[model samples]
Target: MNENLTIIWEKCLTFMRDNLNAAEDNTDLKKLENSFDLLFDNVQPVSLNNNNLTLLVPSDFYKEYIEDNYLSLLSAALKKNIGKGVKLWYSVMENKPAGQEKPITMNMKGKSVATPKMQETLPPSFSANVINPFVVPGMKKIHIDSNLKADFSFDNYVEGECNKFASTVAKSIAKRPGATAFNPLFLYGGYGVGKTHLGHAVGLEVKHAYPEKVVLYLSSEKFIQQFVSAAKAHKQTEFANFYQMVDVLIIDDIQFLSGKKSTQDSFFHIFDYLHQNGKQIILTSDKAPVDILDIQDRIVSRFKWGLSAEIKSPDFDTRRKIIVDKLSRDGIVLTEDMLDYLASEVKTNVRELIGVINSVIAYSTIYKSDLSLELLKETISKIAANQKKVINIPYIQDVVCEYFGIEREQLLSKTRKREIALPRQLAMYFAKEFTNATFNKIGEEMGGKDHSTVMYACDTIKDVSKIDKEIKKYVKELTEKIKQ
Candidate 1:
């Protein structure tokens, strides 16, 4: 057994030597040896599985310490010599030994002194004390709540032309929690557009992968609230210490911090500390950092230092996918036409989109209503339409001109021409249908045409749109653009 122990120790040492770049000086080697000796004295080997070493310690304290202090070194050593894809498991043993020695002690001089027997058995090169920079001393381990959903991972995030860039950057930052590429990832988008969800998801991923890593997920408002609480309790230093030590910091709804100068100052210091220390910082807001009102220039510049991504409103296909995913999860089925109509009308936000689906499900459950397109439109109109703004006429006109390969003046001009008149009449028809405007008002906006002419154009376009596939496609595209 002693011979086997010696061989294992030699192998571990050899692995360490091959991986680490600790100074070859005698002083550094002695320190590393001492750390290993102290670690081994406290840790015991468990059963091996699949070529992985499972070392069991006596307490959570040792488990965390070993992970923080030496896990990287061990992993590096194993991967360098044993090849890639090596894994190590460090678990805490539940039962204590009958007569375990006292835990290793650090003297007033900052030297780690082992027990007498341990000192005798420990190698000469393993007697000195060495400081490990990676180990965070006196960190209070936080337990994660298991009730949080796991499906909010990067895998489930749907990428579209609108949000593909943002999604990719978010995944990269989550996978590698540090200032590798995007130091402080800034994501901004409209409400109910998944900005907060993505921020929290990144925090969950980092925390799950590296349990020892201290990740704090809080809204900017909550952060301010905590800061204020700490100030009132005269625990300002304690609060500062708590934030300064975190490994990954995620702040959601950062736009709330825009006008609060004092809060921004405190946050500036916290941001600087974590960023300077190579830690990861992620932020989400409704607008880009520059557009956020009253934010200090320094803070704004720091926010823009990393990558910026925006989550635009989802397209038709993406919205339909979201509805289908939600309905499937709830075990509710709907006809194809009904699904298409919901996706078409509830095109504003994800929250509203899902709310429409839920209302339909509720109506079916309570009223025994058959799920049909007309029924969906009625139920969805009651809830979803109230939440939606009747899209403005000028907005439609601008969107139509932008969509079609033409200028606003060209569309409004009275040429009776086929190319321009067709688009101009379609815009007038949509404006009258979508807005609470009379034909006179609509005609005036369309370059002051007569109300009769507006009525004739509207009538002509309605008939033409039904038969003209090209006109129908352009109108649909223009409607979608304005809704977004």
Candidate 2:
């Protein structure tokens, strides 16, 4: 009977491959086979009892993953290979928590709770072992909600020339976490360039594959806030210890650690321990490791130990694919010309591209208007006009410097004189206003100024603009000129 089950499972796998790989594309066939290897190769045939086929799985995570992701496929395969109305059962070989082993049975009936549409998405239980190393008291094991959204899967991500290299590297790292040379994979690019999305995607991939491994995704700003909280609560060692226990650590916007000495020191220790122990560490930043200012040299040097891939703004073809993928997922179809028109008009980044698509769809639905190239052109132009300017850091600096009758270098100087200080502040103000740069980034443009320093400068400018009429005039006039 067990031998029969083996033959049945093999036939099922073959059937699956044939069904999924019917396409002539070698790449698609290879991908289907690869997914089969990861998902089904480990599934061992245990026994066949009275219309129920029990399969032995490695872990409970493995069972849940198969059920959530491939239950439909597996069930159909069994019906085709075995017989109708034969259900599948899961027997975990090693279901242990804190050294206690137990057996778990999962009977996936046709009436399972999860809908078919969500089968492709991961279950929240993927974040089973995630715990906040900080803020949780007393218990060595603490629970923290994972920010890695299941919606941020690679299936949802659009692969383009700009991100193809990074995407490939990230998938490789996910398949072989901590063992790959892409340890501490550094992704850098402008805002809305999908850096954070890719980072979350990598974390989700690792979690889906290695559910037993602890994977946590926290932004650097949140890391700093937690560090501050941990310091005040006097649980610094506990915090560090908790983090060191993570098998895969993903930190976004590592540039936010700039100019922060103690946070850098703490993170450096954690990073060194994980790297030495062959655990994976992935970091995302707006700037590359070398360009990240004020971080400790040791930390910066370690960031270079692995791959550094940049995902720039999507190209024209990439943008078009993004639009198609996004709208198709939502089950909304537009004419190819409308898609191409939006693709050409919104060239900033994926975030804006999707935002433009959403706006267009909303307009069409609300006004009951048919999609047209002219309407898309009008809508995108209004968005551009609303932005008021095509301003970046350099452009803001140029406008502010020229307005103040000072050289561009004056605003970038380390030592701010009374004369140059206001101009510098205005530049930061305009940068904050006209660009999507973070405060720390604006500070970097203004010569290594810290986050708080940038906030103070912006505040001072706002206050002075209210009461000081001349400063107010400067703000109003510079704002218009920059918009121009």
Candidate 3:
């Protein structure tokens, strides 16, 4: 009975798919196909005839839900396969097959079987809806969902000057996907700079807008791991086949693929196949394509074929805006002064800024304390200490000179005029504080002044900044600029 039922079920599915494809859809046809697949893959026919066709589902919920939402479509498709006179009946199975370690379904031979847990360990084979494992040959179609993150949508992504262009392009790609010229949108930036966020945002947006499209976001490490597993299982062809069917493939941190020659070689073919077929590919890395080490020139050439956008550290204003948005979402109200303090102090990346925010908010809730500047300072001080600080003396000089509207040479000269002298001293102070240079080196770098003069200049700025708010403000602004 199961053998005959399986054959009839396969016939009905083929008929329905061909019929649906012929009609233009207001509904997502792929989604409907997936719903059909889920039912057919897990459920089986108990009996069939011209007058009535009865099916056995795994549980009562499955029976009822399928009858309510999918009965009409299934009935229509069945009529086309059997006849319009046939009535469809669905009921829960009285007993699951015995001696089964996993969910059991009837294979084509009328024998109950379970997909090996080992096979399930492999990455999902291509399908339209959920993460389903590949079944034995001549069985019903199974679908595994694209592993996109639900929370990583565009609505939550905070836009700033640093990532505006990249965000805009990502949105455009999401709307059109492979139809756009930015087929392989490469996003590169240092840690915590929104590259991964933007990559996931694009995939989520694509899945939301185009339900029929298969969008997969994977880290290069995971991809390599899967490829190695597939090769070990001798299912390399199946692995290649699965990825080839994806509509959009997003690989995060492609730098991780460096030094893995076999993984890179396999990915190169997959990359070529997808690109030639008009599929969209998005990649993220810590560095630009050219800067990525140990990668093949051919693979790097393909990455360069599309757009490469870099997300830099957010400027102080952008960082402040991000904090305001994040706090507003968390229902935490903080003053502008407090926000500015965070923006200026946590000057490295968005992730660290957000980490500090979460920590402080969690601490406040546990202690029943209002969020305050003191709590923020305490939270950020610990985080900032752990973070590696970047020191650039030339950048500091440029910022100081720009603030005073003096020539670069004037900032480095021996002139004692008040304007030049003050700016020069400010430059010296920043060089000593920010860089690893010795006092002698700082003095030599700044107008060939002696070590004592550099020390005096640092002392004078420190004393004046304490007494003058404007001077303090200048130092703070200059420090922030240099950090950025």
Write down the TM-score for model 2. Answer: 0.58
In terms of lDDT, model 1 sits at 0.68
Quote each prediction's TM-score: 0.52, 0.58, 0.53
lDDT of 2 by residue, 382-429 (tens): 777776545798667766766788855466776668789888888888
Badly placed stretches (over 4 Å) of model 2 are 1-24, 28-141, 385-390, 394-443, 446-484
The Cα local distance difference test for each model comes to: 0.68, 0.76, 0.74
**Candidate with the greatest lDDT versus the true structure:** 2
Better of 1 and 2 by lDDT: 2
Taking the tens digit of each residue's C-alpha lDDT, what string does model 1 give over 182-252?
76889886667788777777877887788888777777887888777766765555556566667888888
TM-score, candidate 3, is 0.53
lDDT of 2 at 297: 75
Tell me the lDDT of model 1 at 446. 76
Report the CA-based lDDT of candidate 3 relative to the real structure: 0.74
